[model samples]
Target chain A: MTNRSFEQVSALLDDAIADTREQAQQLDTLLSDNEAQQVWARYALYGRVLKGEAAAQAPADISAMVAARIRQEAPPSQVVQGRFGKHRMARWLRPAGSVAIAASVALVAVLTVQQSQPVAPEQSVEPAFATNPLGGRSPVSYNTVLQQNAPSEAERAQQLRLLQSYMLDHSQQLQLSLQAQQLNEQSEAAAPQKDDN
Target chain B: MNNLKQQHHKKMITNAWRSSITGLLLLCGFLSSSAISQPFQVTDSNQNQAVALYDEMARALRELNFEATLVRSSGTRLEPMTWLHGVYPDGTEVELIVMLNGPDMRILRIGDDTSYYEPHDEAYTIHSDVTFGLLPAAFYKNFSELQPHYQVVGGRGVRVSGRNTHFLRILSRDNDRYHYGLWIDVESKMLLKMQMMTPQGDILEQLQVTTFVERENVPIGMSDVRGIPRPPRLYEVRNLRPPQFNLQPQWLPAGFELLRAGHRRVADSGLPVDYYLFSDGLTEVSIYVGSQQQQGLPSLAMQGRESIVNSTQQNLAVTAVGKVPVTTLQRMVDSMRAVEPNATQP
Candidate 1:
């Protein structure tokens, strides 16, 4: 019925058919188009040959391969508009119901996988050493470390200063542990070897 | 028929004897176990009494409007603080602790939001019930909650801070951690003096809270805090960063868990450091990890039980400061494992 049927069937084989409407509008043409039918049959035979069902040689024509490559190289499609497009689409819509079925199957697969995705637990920062972290009710002063003697008064001053700030931060920033989660996500997204280099 | 009857009677007598022997064995086992546990029960009762006093002190600390002056004694150094706690007519609790000897260091708590104003550092707030440093949370904490790892024993009554007080010796059940001896006021159930002691009964540090007043209503000192609106809830805190744990100390003494971790810089010297605070319910230690800029650091600085230990691991200078033993700190530093990150910034 139309010369473009061969190309449409080839696009369908490549899973690159853009419009369900266009394919349905040309279904009779594709069935009647001898060259398109021959390509389809050859593809089926070639698949059987792969499965060792038929002792056959390789396909003689590379037209289907060329068609798939052409489809890949083609510019992406835009929405079809205008009165004529609507007129054709209305007629093709009934047959194109099969496309919706295929889409529903794909959606089910995606949704099933989404349902299995586990959710990460929530974490909140609590007072340090005051009690059990898993929520035992206690406020016992938490005990931490020990250091050797500072070499000199100045060194001791520096150590003392560091210790003061460190302890201050230690005591003050109990909620900082919440940042660990963001740190984990950032680590995965960021490029490796960026820490020291 | 008579022989059969006699045999049946003999079997019943044997069965009864066996059953009686089994019952006797079971009774003996139970008695022995109970006898062995009788001393444990006595200790438990004594511990319970001490813990009851501790709980009373904890409740008093929370519910009472009190103004207390505290002095921290560790070796020759002495630091003082003014601790105030009160509740509003609306049931909003306010607690404030201003370090008297420090450079404008203080901590304020309004309900669950706690704020810290360190001497030269940007004052920041956290959502927590307990404040760190100065007078620790342990003083007002229920001692029974530290059980399984810690135990409390009743000690002889003694006068402390001009009040008749009873001593409640609270220590680790396994003797692997620091111990505390609290002198609680008998009448008021307030803690007057707390001694951080070692397993050897040596005092590591002592905090003496001289009770000035425990008012029935809100303390007058809290007038400054009343109507003081809570600080604006922090922005979605992405920009306000905390110290991150890039290097984690994998080993800790038993019962110690990471309480908090953050990144900060020393005000005296611009030294960026990563630190982790670990606690064992009673005592806490801070482990600081920073890049080794120059050579190694001072291996240690120990004054009494308080110690600051430094070591270099994987080009990162690690320091641990706490009131625990230096060896434990060193072991913790040695256990530093650099977290494998996809991206790292030194």
Candidate 2:
């Protein structure tokens, strides 16, 4: 049998498709040919892999060639509907191993969230009163706690710096307000007598 | 095995050092709290005498020739400065404040003009009666004018800064403002210590004169300031344009009056903000409105007795800060209503 007949038989086994009468006639030609029967035996071994049986003697290059053929033709698999059903390895994992992977991923996400519960100091600030002795600052410093959580360190620092600048500017700078007050009251009050000589 | 022993010894030393530091900090905290526990009495006092003493201090602070070496203590910060006041031979009043710790924060008030000489910043002068130092401007103004909003009570005698002082307390008549405690020298009437406190006896800020020199002449510092030539006041902000936007505050404490309404840029950061300054003679509160939301202070944030309240409406951030109650600040922020640009306030 020719290489074309071997390819035809291989496609027929991988897809489990002899849907058209023309394909049936072609498979009939492959079954009567010699080389096509060897291709058929290799596919039978691949089929045993789906049946929970060992196929240790199967050639490694056969699996590679099948992957190459799938990439080149982009075949619409008749036996497979969803993405997982396309590959022989994934075909065995479909309804059970996929569930196990999903469960592990969800477990990891929940644990990550739990480990980060107390990380956001700004959002977690409670209504704090000035109860600190010495009448010092009341907000608890989160610096030591935040060392382990590296992502938000720079952002929290920026917020605190901005807040400080706001307080300092308002409390310290009075040039503008003084100007307004000065012009409002011009004579005989606070300081400058405007040297009206 | 020897290396492991060295590491263990180092760990033990570090642990001891940390515990000692913690113990010292706790002890300091206990001492300061105990200092405040003996409340300054706010009882029946001769209101007329209290007013007379306060009026005398305000006048002495402006007209006296003396040098006051003091430190303003608030929270964990200490700012030491020398305040010198004197009269020149040509009838010019000169007052100079030299910041002792920082780099070149000198303020000189020659009569009504105040000049600030700050390092790394342009030295500018403005026409004003007093420098906007941490010192309350009311200390140089007429305090009796604010008597309607406060009840002045004379407390027991106390010694401050090596001088016999008459202790006095000023309580807000209706809890509309912060209370004040004063210790004025009996001889010169100069204030030796002034405490701004919450109504609940929590001291927010304290300014204490550590050393005071009653000068026979113009204070040496003020005389030096007179010889230090000043550039002509050519850059003073004059012809002030009225505020463009109307951030009309609907509610204010009784006796509070709008002194100034205009636009201003925040110092250092140079962020543009429109503001209004209100004063009830003794204390001042300022309300700022700006579009930059990041500069808004957190809700009910207190720095010493200054309460800052920030609120947002239609993307505009409103900030009100003063040495008043946080509830009053929040209420002021709540009462603020933003109107159209240049619209007349109703």
Candidate 3:
């Protein structure tokens, strides 16, 4: 892209970041006050972020801080299972633990740079491979660990079935009310000589 | 050069004199023909003579003793109604009896009050206006005023009920109202037959006299036919109250006036329906406003002599009714709106 196009893209990204921060702040306030509103807002925000909009990714430091918070507040198995599902929990946990290991290696590079030594060529590729896994088995092994440590399958299945039944019953009651209303209208039309002249 | 100038001035004077003389001669010839033809053409004289004739006709209508059968033809249906009218010599007694078949209907009018008798309903007194149907009393009260709005043309003379009649056409000046043609008796000027025509020249309704009698010797009791029970009052009607409109329209077609206004209870929701009526000397229209639901929009349906047009806004329905064209009805419906306090002329 031309320099001008690059600048335009950067400005758009800046706007997107500002808008996301405002919405996040609003969601935080709503979460403390209105439970229903907060749940709906979080679902809407998740839909926006998953739509492949490049502007959804935060700055590197902010992402790391958020990840740290998740680690501190939630058990690793719960975080892995929530994002990747119970079936895929084992696959996500293995790569996530490796990322923590890569983070420690990046700390050593920072210390070497400050000592005024040129980094070795082997160390140059270390950050890339550590941050992201390349092999397919890596994801599978990671998920297996998360699934074993998370909730049991039978408990999750029972809760899902209850929610489905409740929704079906509510819809059936609405259909019955509509049928009764139509019957009343038909009877009124049949009795024409009641009052009108 | 002097001779040429003198010749040109003489030629100009001669041409002017010749043209003026020709103009004067033409004017004289035209005036003479108009004077001679004045007696031949109907409605050539001032309205004073027509007004006098109208007064005489009204007096004859009030004083004449006659029993005639009138056949009212509308569309493909023909209805025959027998009418009996008489006036006492003392000018105090008057009676009119009209009887209809099929449904077995009879209307008896004594002075101002009228009583209707029907097979399924008991006899009861009704307002004089109801007895007239859609006929305005202004036709009988001051028909001379209509002369200005209608052309009085002559039609083929005919004989009705052994009385000599001359046809008098009352063509309307505009298509805004219906036209009428009446056959009046030459001697008494009493209307013998009348036909009402639409704008397209189609006859909507016609009342023709099959038979009529001019009675010089009639019994006094004929003017006082009694013992007829009045029809039961099936409908209790009060004058519709006028609505307090926040805005009144600044422009309306000429010859229209507010007739009545009031609220009616809608059958479905029992909500109050606002209604208003306006009339020119001839045509009448009723407008209605009410809260709109899915069914509250004005729907149109035609039954015999009546046609209704309805329209709805966000929450208001407006309906206009008359014998007017559908376009006119739609225009009236669209013009109605809730008046705002600060409405200004555009």
Candidate 4:
């Protein structure tokens, strides 16, 4: 029989062709032929799988050696999605990460350069009070009184440092004397207790 | 087996330490409560009332074991802090000032050394009786010393901190300096509020006590801070010759006497500065003289209650700093003159 006859037989078995006397005769003929019966059995198995009626069994007809070899290799189904997705993402991020790091480094370089520039007199003297115990009240410089918004001469900065140091020393001295007085009183108070003992 | 034995020993030691700390805290709490139950005497006398009030307040500050939450305002900035003062059984004075907002700025005074602890700075110690940064130094001094510089007059009685208070106006003897107004608790003679004002009545700075708690036992932080080592001394006046200034002040305000006259190395710089310290008992003014060509002092600066006036005479640069009006400091500058080669200057 021609392959066209086999195709008619397959369609009749699936109930896709019109049921008639002619299709019934074709189905009977295909059932008698062993080769056509094998083809019909294969189509029935594929249909069972599509309907999810059976477990997805490996081809038992294949040799054991061939099945084992296939299992040893990477699974073909997941290889493309898993490996290639991560690879593509990493390729895109490389240049972006480099740019971010470079931008931060450039920002730090700019800040360092700005610090070396001469500061305005007000900006320089006013901020020193933040860290000073006297806060913003302490005097700066010994000769030239710096007015608001005036330009600070580089040499005057040294004089300011000296004046601040002097003020700190003076406060320290006051604290020391106070401490000494307290200590003396403490010893004096202890003297009577010692005598009683 | 040896390791297991060592672990058990460590656990026992830890348990003992915990129990001891708990016992100490309970004892302190009990003692403090008992002390607070005692009635504090407050004198409201008609004879020498202002002088007696001042004396009583000074004594309360030095002798009382108390804690106060105060608001200290300078210009537009206001700082809220808790001040604790206690006397140990051994007679050592312990005080703590804890800032309530922002960074933890703490100053702990145990006997002689006052140590400052701040978040950004290294903890350092200063030798002081009372922490200078919290209250005016003059408040701790004897009332007799303050008489010449200030006129302590009694003002109308008012209520402060929920207590009946008497106002003591510490008016400057001269018009050139700032004045202070104090509200003393009538019952305890404890200072409830103090304001430093300009000659024109502009408030420069103020300290108001919101809560005053008197406890008999030492405060909590005071006992804990006793173990912390004091920082090294920052200033040492070694064997160095005193400086001779070419210019000297010709006049000083009434009753203000020269305390000391000497020269010290201007800060860390090797440059010499002539320093003259003058006081009228309560108020102190420091005059620093540096070479005009070497150092540049600001012409005039005023922050809160303190004013600094700077002037140049001949080759000398003179700067005066105190809680005084600009005119008073300016008068000091105007009074400077060059001394003769053979003549001694005071």
Which tens-of-lDDT digit does each residue in A1-197 have in candidate 2? 66776677777877745568857886787768776777788777767867748433322232233224324422222222232222322112111101122223332332244336643432212222322121343232233233454435455445444444445555443444665566567754645666462
> Of the pair 2 and 4, which is ahead by TM-score?
2
Candidate achieving higher DockQ, 1 or 4: 4
Off by over 4 Å in 4: A1-173, A176-197, B1-47, B118-122, B233-235, B268-271, B301-304, B340-346
Candidate 3 residue-wise lDDT, B57-97, digit = tens? 65666667765566776555566665556655555434443
Clashes of each: 22, 2, 18, 14
Best candidate according to TM-score = 2
Worst 10 residues of 4 chain A by lDDT: A90-99
Docking category for candidate 2? incorrect
- Model 4, span A1-197: residue lDDT tens: 57886677668767877768877787787778887777777777777867867542331221132224323534322332343343332221111102122223332332233335433323323433343223233343322333333434553454445444444434443444455445556769786554221
State how far residue A65 of model 1 sits from its true place (Å). Answer: 94
What is every candidate's alpha-carbon RMSD to the true fold? 34.3, 33.9, 42.3, 31.3
TM-score of A-chain in each prediction? Answer: 0.22, 0.24, 0.20, 0.28
Q: In model 3, how many backbone clashes occur?
A: 18
lDDT of 1 at B126: 48
lDDT of 2 at B272: 66
Scored against the native two-chain complex, candidate 1 gets a DockQ of 0.02
| Cα lDDT of model 3 by residue, A56-164, tens digit | 2232233244224323432322323234443432222111002122222332333233234332322222233343333322211212322344334454333223222
Across B191-225, the per-residue lDDT of candidate 1 in tens digits comes to 78888865556676788975446668765555555
lDDT by residue (B1-346, candidate 2, tens digit) is: 9999999999999999999999998787566544533444332235556778888998888777876678887655577776767777776788776666645456677887776654433344567777675566777776667768877877566889768998879888766577889999999999999898876667767899877777677754344454344423423245556655577788888889987677766444555677687888777788877764546433333334455556664456677767776656655666777566555421
lDDT of each: 0.57, 0.61, 0.46, 0.60
Interface RMSD of each: 32.1, 31.1, 43.0, 26.3
